[model samples]
Target chain A: MEHTWDFAAILANWRVLWVGLQGTLIVFAATVTLGLGGGLLVGVCRYAKTPLLRLPSMAFVEVFRNTPVLVQIIWFYYAFPILTGIEVNPFLAAVLGISLNTMAFSAEIYRAGIQSIEPGQWEAGRALGMAYQQTLRRIILPVAIKRILPALTNRGIEVFKMSTLASVVAYVETLNQAKLIADLNFNPIESYTAVALIFFAVLYPAVQGTYILERMLRKSE
Target chain B: MEWNFWAVMTDFDLLLLGLVNTLKVTALALLFGVPLGLCLAVLRLSGARLVSAAAAFIIEFFRTTPPLVQLFWFFFALPILIDVRMTPFIASIVTFSIQSSAFFAEIFRGGIQSIDQGQWEGGKAIGMTYAQSMRRIVLPQAVKRMIPAFMERSIELLKTTTLVSTVAYTDLMFQANDLAQKTFRPLEVYTVVALMYFALIFALSQLSIAVEHRLAKSGDSTVR
Candidate 1:
């Protein structure tokens, strides 16, 4: 049996798809902002060598990084409310889930970045009478961030792709919106194809931009 | 509600069933993915530019796209497009094998590239056919170098089996999600599932490290 392709239905639903695009952007923005902020703190805590902070940070990274993100999302949507007695909006829950998950990964990336610096850099800063905090902020961190940006950017892209899973929790992101349209219109192919194209449009450029940035940074070095 | 240790223990059968299915998918994915990946890798490295480019595009497409979307496409979209129905198990296996081959291709490519140019020339000097040299000389060394990467991808593929849950596959994650919804105890159920995944990946990683150390020691003797 041959099913006729319908372009008109998709065209009519353009507004819905556009709204879905907005949702995707919002979630992506929120996840990047919060994930990076939380990741930075977690990374720093892991590096600090304080027993209280280091142990917990280590555990958090290991657990989150190892498990699947889909399971974590389900946990947040279903379990977090029971644990905390506070309801989370689907968008917030998705943002928090993706952010926390990416944080675990970013923390390790940051730790590796900081550790990859030559020990002599730290020693020279100390010999120059710079305080530990000053040495790190002024010398170590700048070098480390520059060196790790490629790895970090790659992780950021992974998180961006992963944001599609937010649909499972009913977040109305691009994929979720497409799924809804498909269910309503009974055209899963068109709906999902459009969604895939939109995702590729957004992600392809970001990937190219990262590569360009990496090259420019490398040239400067 | 109080913790029902006995009730949870009795449900061990359910968990065990889920674990069995999970292992089945993981093993099937590896069995299909590794050999296909190797073939794709060889195809990409073939002297023919069109073949290499085609292989590269397929790899890039699969690698960059989300596996969940790919799974959905295989499970839902492809049948609509082609008018052929696939069982969920078949769809899961096909999608996973395709997805994993992209990763394996890159790993194998890296392994092949790491071999010295002298080895290829040495094989030619000995009047061995290219295919025979690859089989007898090049591949054994490449396989050694490829082990750590192969192990890493296996761990990733194992975790990715959770995406099967999206297609309503009754894997471990699906069981956890169902149990969480039923018991209204998401944390406990998911935590258990996560711990199971962690244990398996950790053990695999440790095994990879042991193999890597052995490979490094052997390489040192050969270099000397």
Candidate 2:
């Protein structure tokens, strides 16, 4: 089959693409916020001595990290309503799904970071007369966060990319919006290529930025 | 909601079928992917600049892009580029193999590079050709170094197989979607599916730990 490439059609719908971009950004922002918070809690919980908290947190991380995000998104979108009798919008469902998935990965990253701190740091904190909470909040978290910033940034990029999966559940993110346009126009290549470019535009910079930030952090150290 | 053992059990058959398909895809992908990865790794490590650059480009392109996009491109976009049709399963296998190969290449390269330069010199001094040295001595040691990374990559590939459903391939996640839509019990069905995945990955991780421990014990005396 011979076909002419139509740059005009894609450019004509640039507004729609922008709207889709907004949706993608929203999901990325929401997932990062919720994921960081949830991941920190889960990470700290894993280090907790209490079996009640640690066991469940361990199970949560295992389940989320093992399964695919598509399954998790569908499960949350469909199962959440049935189990709770409250219907969640597709966007919210996508946010929650990505957040939970990112939490699992971030939890592991945090654990690795926290474990990397020298035992002497803890001893020194105690020597300085800081309480456990104070040491964790003021000293330990700062050091651990600095050490893990590179990994966390990498995880953030991952979360940004995985947000594309949200399109599967009918969330009008960039990819889903592209799919809709493709279906309507029967031009899958143009639509998806546009979406791919948009995603690259967003993601590539974040990844590059992370590397730069990591180098800067190392230099300051 | 009330517990429905019979209903859940009846659906168990379909779930099992899905599990089989999941394993089939995972196994087939790995079968093709690992060797392709090793080849790419070797090529990348080749003393020739052109070969290394080409291999590096292939690895970087796949590694940086999202797998779902790669899947869509292979399944949908590539057919448009080339005048040929491929089945979803075929497309999935090809795409995943290519993607996994990139990861495997990096892992293998790291393993191979970690070996001391003295080892290579030692093999060459014994009158072994480069290929012979790599095959008989270097590769075996590299494989030992690579086992942990290999296990981790396998788990990653297995988890990534869930993305196959995006192209309308019927794997465990697809079955879970279908069952959830039919039974309207997304939470329970997905919970079960997630649990199965967790069980498999957890087992693989345990197996990896055991292998690493065994290798460490045997290789302790050889440490420099």
Candidate 3:
């Protein structure tokens, strides 16, 4: 028996790869939007030290942050349907699981960013007869956003990378699609290597761009 | 679909196997990855431009890429390329060590760079080699300061070991998924697994906090 590299087999499945790329991107974008918004609410609640709100949000963050998303995806894929009697496709389930998983980490990031603002800013806002809401809206948010923009961007890149985990639930993301094609043609090296490179290409620039943005922001300060 | 606590308990052996595998992988990865990553950090700080550039490239490339995909590539492709048949466990170790090493390399570099320049010059005044100075002066302080960050990375690595199940290595996630599929009691089975993970990681984070408090009490802020 003779074996050789067979990239052409994978190349023939370009449309699947393209669709997989779109799937990955769609999940990434959805997680980013939902996770960041949820994280902001959780972060604010926890940071403001509201006992009832803070305790549950903190618990949510701790649980989600600790567990692997692979289990979360599986649980949501199977358990959610059983619990709710609502069947979701792999894509939707992966998105929900990953969003919740990422939301916890993002909430922590948001908390740090929120706390980076000095307490004096809050005092001054109160001195101006503004509500806590107004102070957060006008002052804390702006500074925190400036400080944590790069961090949030970094997390966005991570969420994109994490989308690969969706492959486990039989989601037709790039890695799973590549695996199907690879197994078909017995071109694991070429197929998987190309998949890795595809991820690298999508993710590398985003990470480096964040670095440059952070440095520039630091300089301007 | 029914929640059966006893069913999950009966299958706890499988879950425990997965848990053991996960811990084994994590401990091995940290044991190897930390030192390898430290070397990578030193390479990145090498006097030669190309050495540092190569180190930086490897670190950034792995850091940005997906570890799960890397695991897939190594598990499926490496045997074909290298003409060696390795177990899924070995493949996971290979993939994770490389990936975690990249992450730890960055952490190590951060720890190293935070050491004051005057300390390095002081080492020069004592006519100590870079290696000796690092052994005696820089590393002791840096490693202490890095304890919290190291524990955080360890927790990340532990969470990451769950991915080993994807390669059919029967890690906790895999076993839970397997149990769910076989028993049709996914809600009950997966809930147990998730809680186990929560307990383990929460304990680790608490330990990290305790270590941080001890560091503060000792007044061992390294920069001084």
Using all chains and alpha carbons, the TM-scores for the candidates as numbered come to 0.91, 0.90, 0.96
- Where does candidate 1 stray beyond 4 Å? A1-5, A213-221, B1-6, B213-224
lDDT string for model 1 (A1-221, tens) is: 57677757778899898988898788888888788779978998899867899999988987777777777777778767767878887887788778988899899888988898999999999999999788888899899999899988988888878888888888887788787788898888788777767767777777779989999999988
Residue-level lDDT of model 2, residues B1-224, one tens digit each, is: 65454554679888888888889999999999999999999999999999999998777667666778778877877777678777889889998999999999999998888888988999999999999989988888888878878988898898889999878788888887788778866677887887777788788878877877887778721222
Query: What is the lDDT for B65 in model 2?
Result: 69
lDDT, residue A24, candidate 3: 90
What is the Cα-based TM-score of model 3? 0.96
Which fraction of the native contacts appears in each prediction?
Answer: 0.44, 0.43, 0.82
Which tens-of-lDDT digit does each residue in A1-221 have in candidate 3? 24677678777899988988988988888999999888898889887656888898888998898888877888898888888999889998899989998889889998998888889999999999999999999988988988999989988988998899888888888888888888788888898889888988978888888889999999987
Candidate 1 clashing pairs, residues 3+ apart or interchain: none
User: Once model 1 is optimally superposed onto the true structure by TM-score, how far is the C-alpha of residue A191 displaced, in angstroms?
Assistant: 1.9
iRMS for all predictions?
2.0, 2.0, 2.2
For candidate 1, give the lDDT. 0.82
Every candidate's TM-score, chain A alone: 0.94, 0.94, 0.95
Model 2 misplacement above 4 A: A1-6, A208-221, B127-129, B216-224
RMSD of each: 2.7, 2.8, 1.8
What is the lDDT for B19 in model 3?
A: 89
Candidate with maximal lDDT = 3
Error of 3 at B8 (Å): 1.2
